[model samples]
Target: MKEARPWLRPDRAASGGDIWKKMKTGAGGACGEDEMSGEKTILVAGTWDTKDDELSYLSDVIRGQGGQVLSMDVSVLGDPKLPTDVSKHEVAEAAGSSIQAAIDSGDENTAMQIMGAGSARLALDLWREGRIHGVIVLGGTMGTDLALDLCGALPLGVPKYVVSTVAFSPLLPPDRIPADVQMILWAGGLYGLNDICKASLSQAAGAVLGASRAVEAPTFMRPMIGMTSFGKTVLRYMVTLKPELERRGFDVAVFHATGMGGRAFESLAGDGAFAAVMDFAPQEVGNHLFGGLSAGEGRMTHAGRAGIPQMIAPGCYDLVDFVGWQGVPAPLRGRECHAHNRLLTSAMLAAEERRAVARSICEKLAGAAAPVAFFLPTAGCNEWDRAGGELHDAAGLSAFCEEMRSRSPVNVDVLELPCHINDVAFTDAVLARFDRWVAEGVISH
Candidate 1:
């Protein structure tokens, strides 16, 4: 139905590869005149054919907040109830497919995938050109996927939001989610403008516009330092470390070593988002190595490999996470267990596994092209690993230490301090080593 388009990038569809491709050019038009009016242009994205009234209501709510709305129709079904700035056909075509092709294939899932990919590409193009300040979409499961894809296309700062019936399901894969993208459970967002539906739509629209107005892309004079740690039970050193880091003129961003948090940390580091990294409590590493859902495959690798000055610690290395008592796997059933809460538990790791984890960590860090520092506190790695505590595993931890020291890369400055991970001496040792690296010009203060 149109001229040939050039491809810029190919993205995976639910079907497979090449089902969705971003175009180099299409209807690359601005959303509206709001770009220069000091008014935010909010992209109201959804299947306008099915949820017309709901999408329109959101647009009205956004406009009421003094923001302009760009209705990007991603519908693949019948005619749209309302006209959109970017039409469904445009979105489909932009994704290296067409709505008619999807319709001919007679697959709702495939059609949604094509439109979602196209819509994301279009939204990103518009965003890159400052045509839209934020995006808001409302839907059930299919709509949620499309919304998530669009949100993923934008970076950390843009106001991307999804009001979805399935907000907490597949969205749990934090690696696929953009770090700052927000979501609201779609209690009544899929249907007409009733009292219940209107309340949620209004909130979503307002939240996005407010986010757009309030969020400024972070600019910094001092280099930002990214750190990873768990909760208080495992973050005793971080409390002293982070403030000292800030006092020395480095802005530090601490990532809780939850599965998703580590996912974000990895993404941010890979993108050179942080000038340096202090990956202290890499509990996710053990989680990944032991089939725990919260750990990521590349937890400790990105920061160091980014050629940034990184200080790596095997913090909380003695335990692997299992949620609740019932979640303890059969293999770890009798192991020393610490109940952090009704929802979270830590199980003591075995010596063989600890040694394997340490070797793997060294292998990962071996690719570092910048200043690398590895420190191990020989006493223990976390609260439950210290004296007379539950989940103690000094034998396993020492095994890790021994393996790490043997495999430590020549470029890395490795240290084994004779103190518990939470002890003041351990913190002091970490600071002193970092200070030395800075003085040696391997890093800047």
Candidate 2:
């Protein structure tokens, strides 16, 4: 049997505060004592066999800054000079495989897939056990690939910093990245540690540790309601709904319905974090289907899959958002357009497109495992689409409403209201159903 490492020795484990004491008085020079109440334990993970020096530098910097290190080796073949708290063999086994099996596959992608799966599972376990507060990972591409999965495994607000040679590259898509993760470019240190690379690594260490110390994790004391909307300029219902929901003994979290914001909303919903969902703004659904600025696939499906009661509305569903900086898409080039800003723009859909969007919306809602209420504000779906407004087209609105009322699944209760989406009457209708649901035990109080 191999001898245990010093950090994992039974004696050291029994000394509850030994890790913090040693971190404060470690060999490398200490920065001053942190005013924070407790020492943070940061998970330093990487392909340790190849980038041992870089990973060591990060660990040292974290320790020097009054933080404890939990080193995890994700290497496939070679061993690090120092023992890791979590070994490569252990990581492989976490994924129900072995290092030899990964090597025998004879493919770098295959080996890294095994490592990534193991790393994600171990990282999630560490977080759940309260053994780690933050994570800082280093890699060129393979390490970065594994880093995305590891970060995704943790809930939002846990500090996740990635130092990678391919940081911010096009190779990393919007869907692959977690909403709150921070990434720094690993310049000049691909092969070995240099001054340039050291600068990036040290900053990442301090940032993750500092964030861990400052972060206030969610308490989840109050049952939460998740809602989606654009800014008040377009969707004003949230302005009225947020305070009202709070008064009713529930916490409301309203997410911006842009690409990344919607992605974060879907992620939390997939985790079953919300007691119920008021997913009013589903423009990202049309965006994804039409090759516009998407919130990734499966935008409006998560809460339903989680079996949470849903109140759905077609807020801002008439327009599809795209990257304004890239010019309009070829298919939507000759349509009425509104430039929200330099980064985002919206184009009005034709009547046929509106019917298609209605069909798509009904199709997605058809899979609801729980009850669904679809509110069709017949006057308009958004401020700009109301009568006499800039993008208003009564014909288009009729097309969408007619298709929705005709084709919605039986599981959905299609309420055709005669008010604009931003009208007080519309808000009252939503509140009426919500209150009835709570009273009838369909929604939890």
Candidate 3:
């Protein structure tokens, strides 16, 4: 493993009063030790040399909007306490070692990584001290990178805003902030405090203040029930399992059954994040078994050991996902396939491949406790596998099921539903079995 960053190993750094307090009493007495109370405090962090004029005007606009503003200059090129705002010294003092570590690392990536950790540490400490409810950062590319790191570190519901010159493209690539947070884009560099700066700052302040006032009552305290789904399989879960589970007072958290989606759900289950696993679509494992493109990592089936009430289903197990017709590997170039959409295609898994998938799934479920159940829809498991579609392989599915039943340990109960996976009757059967298990306390509600 790479050597941990200095800021990440803060126990080795120093232990005194908080960074702000130490900065107030040390070197320059730059900022007072007064804590922000009642109203939310917005921490605006940036390079003073580049953003001083912008920061000043933005701070004024925020205060005018009845929000407290605390400006911290991460770059220590000048006095942090300039003409306005809170202690610049405290910000520099806390971030100085981190900035120096980044410079000394020689590798720009490693440097940025350490700096990002430093910013997160600062935000966390401020939040603990009740001095920060939200954070707004202004930057160029480097600044945006550093600020986004801090934004992600804050709580999921906290107000985080970033104004960046590159935010329009590079900074906002996939998404720099979570869906709940706000990010503003500015095309030009921060030359001085202008109208855009004022607007962004004011909006950030109001957001943080509003967020501070909203009471975050616990949404639900019921034991969490995890479900894996795809666009097709999700309908069965949404229309049936979700309402039924909610009626039984179990909080449902659905994870899309894509590769990452399955991995994330498994990880959360392993981390004691859920009380039960209703993994309806084991597509990742199917892909891995079928030599398709959606294969999961080796650890796809880790939920059993986590001791959760696991109920597994092979939703979409009949079809293997592939990108466009041109993107399918040469060996499978002539296989039975269908164009599901412009960017995606589906293919039939061979009998041998289906048997392999069954074996892998059975291997995982074999070790599950008595409460565990594996349901196999004998008619069909997907829209393409029922009535009229290229992927309806009853012979292949039967052969696979027979092999699995013969090979699997008897501890796992395998139920064969006569209805197709998408049918309302099949969904009803699934709910009845699951609810009975939960009601009997075989699986925790």
Best by lDDT: 2
Candidate 2 weakest ten by summed lDDT = 1-10
Residue 34's lDDT within candidate 3 is 44
TM-score of each: 0.84, 0.90, 0.66
Q: Candidate 2, residue 150: CA error in Å?
A: 0.9
The better candidate by lDDT, 1 or 2, is 2
With a 3 Å backbone cut-off (N, CA, C), the pairs that clash in candidate 1 are none
Q: What is the lDDT of candidate 3?
A: 0.63
Better of 2 and 3 by TM-score: 2
**Residue 437 in model 1: shift from native, Å?**
3.9
Give per-residue CA lDDT, model 1, range 112-181, as digits (tens): 8888779878887888678888899888988887777888777667788998877777645666677888
How close to the true structure is residue 300 of candidate 3, measured as C-alpha lDDT? 43
Q: List the residue pairs that clash in candidate 2.
A: none
**Which of 2 and 3 is the better model by lDDT?**
2
List candidate 1 stretches off by more than 4 Å: 1-37, 100-108, 170-172, 188-193, 325-327, 409-411, 439-441
Candidate 2 local lDDT, 1-445, one digit each (tens): 0112232111322222222234334311111224225688999999889999999999999999999999999999899998999999999998889999999999999999898888888887787566788899899889999999888877666789999999999798777788789999998988998898889989999999999988875545566789999988999999889898899988899998888889888777665566688999999988887888789878998778767789999998889999899999998899999999999999998898889989998988899877899999999989998789999999999999999989999999999899999999989999999899889867765
Residue 134 Cα positional deviation in candidate 1, in Å, after optimal superposition: 1.6
